[model samples]
Target: MTQAAMPQVLIVDDDRAMRASLVALLEAAGWRVEAVSRASRVAETLVTFAADVILSDVRMPGMSGLDLLATLQEAFNPPVVLISAHGDIPMAVKAIQDGAYSFVEKPCEPRRLLTILRHAADQHRMRRDTASLRRRLTQISGLDRMLLGQTPGIADLREQVLDVADSDAAVLLVGETGTGKERVARALHDLGRNPAGPFLALNCATLQPAVFEAEFFGVEGGQVGKLLAAEGGTLFLDEIGACPLPVQSKLLRVIEDKQVTPLGATRPVPLSFRVVSATNEDPDAAQSDGRLRPDFLFRVNTFVLALPTLRQRRADLALLMTHFLEEFASVYETVVPELTQDDMAALLAHDWPGNVRELRNVAERRILSARRGGGSVAAAMHKDHELDDVPDTLREAVAAFERELIGKAIRAHAGRMDAVAEALGIGRRTLNEKIVKLGLDKGALL
Candidate 1:
């Protein structure tokens, strides 16, 4: 089997001869190897190496293999194979109980060692993939907590996203510039089966055609292309309307056959990944204008999500503005500034051809307009721009008001929740409920 995407192995042994021998053997077998001297140094080396499986001798001078396994138990430890010169039935059983992958005795057969090590690497890949997928899912789930607003367009888009997130079919995201096509792609990926798999994206409009093939199919210089790197995951082609006609043919082949031949390689590399393409302009117009090929269009048009423009979701503007304010405030480390009515009207009146991205740029400018050194920047902020803090989603609006009320209550009652609830004239149950719902566990006062 080709070792292009094989798991990495780390070998640890105090013996210099043994370390050199193991390194040569693994390298000959088309495996990546990192050799370290002692058990204690494994953790520090792993910080940089990130081994899929560890092979170490049990009877080390300072720290034993069992000790190393115990130390790494709480962390995301890779599968470990412990080798020993004095290994017995009792020692082997003890090693297994201590989480060793296999306990091989000294003078181990090369074939047996290879078999056990490869199996250990396989287990490590599965565990690591699962953990990575879980993390991606959690991150996407948090981003969708409010999803900015409850407009019909937004609601429909969310439903559409869920309906098609699980499929491996090609997805064409059509939208106005800055309508968050990439965000939709990521949501689909996070919800897909291979959430932990690689996500490789290329901007078709930006790539130089002369260099596109080498970049896409990779060169002898070890510059792996998106197709190979994103195996078992998703490959996103951004600005698909600008894709070159020559590249278009090969892209279709890969999409249809799930395989790619590198620039300098003879044989084709097998690839299995979901294709998600996006274009800011109308795909039909592109095809008619000869910018996009008809067959290419048909192949990639398995599913399409037409993202709504900012104008179509004007009802979500106030809440979107609030989300941006909170987000930018956290980013720029500034006090959340106020927006006067004029600012609101200015924002609403504009056609916003550039969509939500344009509004985000305006929000950033609003935050930057306020005086940075002082605390009373909010009062000075609204004088220039007529913009005010307006929460977009129901969750966000409720959270904003809840934060203000609880903050005021805390200040009035000297940070005592019981006293604050009584002073606010609300029951303790209601106050606690609001606190928990608004994510106020570690509030400014408490």
Candidate 2:
């Protein structure tokens, strides 16, 4: 079947008759119409209906149409043409600055209004399309993939990523566990010039303390260490603060001399890789504790990228949710689940200690579980054992249960960190830290 090409316009007015008349006129002009008499309900209506233009009366009871226009400007950019019975040119000009697309006097010139609506719709379509393209480009740039956030803190981090990616400066990514330090490291490698070169990653914490030196400096059998393996590429050392004191000295030598001497071998292997290290611990504290050498810290700290906790970027929940939904849908071969405003509200309300990684897990689980007839993501989320019963007197137990519930939700959402964060009423970054602290395996969510 051929889809209709009519553009949709939402008419908001206090008068039912006026709204009906305007709808009729617009429909006659080969446009699709949705009319809402109450300004208070326009926000909810817009959430469900896709519209090209909005025709709103400037004055209305309860909440003025102007107020609605202001709210819509932040959520979505739709061309809004204000209609005023008592038209004031100055007020209209002010409304334009406040984001109204245009203003028209009421008392009905059907032809003129249609012409204006068409023009406004065209302009809105162009702007929306452009914004969509920019979002796609941002995603393609792998900026969105670094971590989910639209806050100023996140914006600053993104700028740092771009700046540091342009050079070969060694970077130290500082953040709490589960804050996606490794993801940021990968983003740097992907955005850098030698992306095609080997992108090697190793978690310093995963290596046994006894074998730290042998593992990092390579062993005798001619086995190359992670640093040497990433020659002409990127070497990402996660939990760098976890490296043993003795190994720290060896790493410092490699960074200063640009070479690595394998254990039980005299000759040093030339290092030609860009190093990006991550740590959940404070660099200065680690140095004072003798867990990290100050010289090594200075060498790797040529650039520093500190990831913000999820709570700091709550405004980005919707954007991150949308991005993760699309990602999980492709992975599971299912259509993306539609999220209601309440769902989004719940997500924005919670404090996520887990960060972006936790959000991804939750989204993936929700998609898969919902597809299998489990129920809504929010409902399925509550079924986890951790959220099932509350135990009194054990604050630590309660905290642990909360973490478990958050983790289960992430798993059920299929690794969509934003969706899981929303379902659990927590911030994505907060949830990330909790996941790390609780040692939740995101692989379960996938």
Candidate 3:
């Protein structure tokens, strides 16, 4: 492995000699090590070093190792092994209960310590990946108010996605069409333990049962199926509710056995992959209608995430409007049109029955028409309908749009100040100053 790829460890001890000794032990094992003589800087160290495993002495000045563990848990909690003395067994037990990965006794055995460190390092890698994906989810969807907004529903969904991304559990994402269910599945895959592994996605609705056996289970001629293609990664089955009952049985068997039997072949091929499925319809209704098997449903959605429709998350429409405006304008090489107060009200009040996809199309149309100097977006949106009494001035409307625009840019880039600043065409210092002045929340990224 390259030097950068090597596992990085952080050692915390007040005693210089002990700290140096621990650092040598880890470095000798081909691991990169950073040793500190204080627990107060543990948080700073984790961020700066991006350490894979933290080996800290339980007895320390200021905050104890246990206290550091608690503090870190509130943030990006790593796998911490408290190096406790012989008499600190009770304290070690309490530390483990409080969410420390494991504890090692002092006068540590080199072999035992290395074993613990390796395990901790592996877990640390998993958490690191999931955490990165969690951040990217915000960044990629930053302008996407429904998924990356400050609304309670979006906040709840973000938490659920982060919580389940690292696990091997089967996930079922349920939502209306255009609600970005596939995006959630991809996040789970990207944030999974084996992110480097191949991610294979298939639409169950497009599966033709007659040839699906070959498509899913592979042919006897040595063609690999979707199941095998996703080995060591994730297989996302979208619109799973549309799958035929016969296919559902086979899917259940594959999931249960964690193996696949290719067509015209008897012996099964053992495989390792995570399953994340999604549907636009209600799962219970599908089950009742015999479109989905109860056993299959139970096996697939061990962790279910229900996505809200665009109408439910209407608070983000204006932001999404502005975002899509920038999006299509750049695509078609047209200028982004301004949204008057009447336009904003009409867009917000109109229930987007078609959800995000419909809104996107609407934005594209608006941008195209405005490019040809045809008409305003508001006129087109409210062509057949009556306009609401929107009393806000042009300045107020511009300020509101700008706020959401900045907030979305902040979130979409995972709160990386440099990237956010670059995207906004501003300097880092100016962005920080603006955030303070505008009262924008930067905590979500951190």
Q: TM-score, each model? A: 0.52, 0.57, 0.52
Against the true structure, candidate 1 has what lDDT?
0.79
**lDDT tens digits, residue span 1-446, model 2:** 12246788988888888888887787777888899887788768878887888899988888786788778866455778899897788888888899888788878688888888887777666456435644763655457656556589888888889888978999999998767788889889989989889988887767675766676678778666756678889988788888776767766777788887788887888888899999998998998998888888888899888988777777666667667767878887877666654465557665666676666666777787655544454553343425546656588777776766776786778888899888776798888888887777888656
Question: Where is model 3 poorest over a 10-residue stretch in terms of lDDT?
Answer: 382-391
Q: Write the per-residue lDDT of candidate 1 for residues 1-446, one digit (tens) a residue.
A: 55547768999899999999989988888789999888989989989887889998998899988889888785468888999888999989999998888999988999999999988887677556445544543455443643555589988988888899889888999999988888888888988889999888878777676776687788765788756888988889999999888888878888888887778888888889999999999999999999999999998889999999999999777667656765788897877665444455676777878788877776776675442322222332333344356767878877786786677667657778788788666899998888887777535675
Q: Model 2: how large is the Cα RMSD against the reference?
A: 15.2
Please write out the lDDT profile of model 3 over residues 1-446, one tens digit for every residue: 89878988899899898988887888898899998888998878877787888888888889888888887775556688888774376777798899888888878899899989887887667545535534544476422433555557777888888899889999999988988888788778777798799988888888887877788789777787767888899989999999888888888899999998898888888988899999999999999998899999999989999988888887767666777777788898977676654566678778777777778777887886676455566655653342243327977666665566578777778888799888777899988887886678888544
What C-alpha RMSD separates each model from the true structure? 24.8, 15.2, 22.3
Cα deviation at 184, candidate 2, in Å, is: 1.6
The C-alpha lDDT values of all candidates are 0.79, 0.77, 0.79
Pick by TM-score: 1 or 3, better one: 3
Candidate 2 positional error at 34, Å? 11
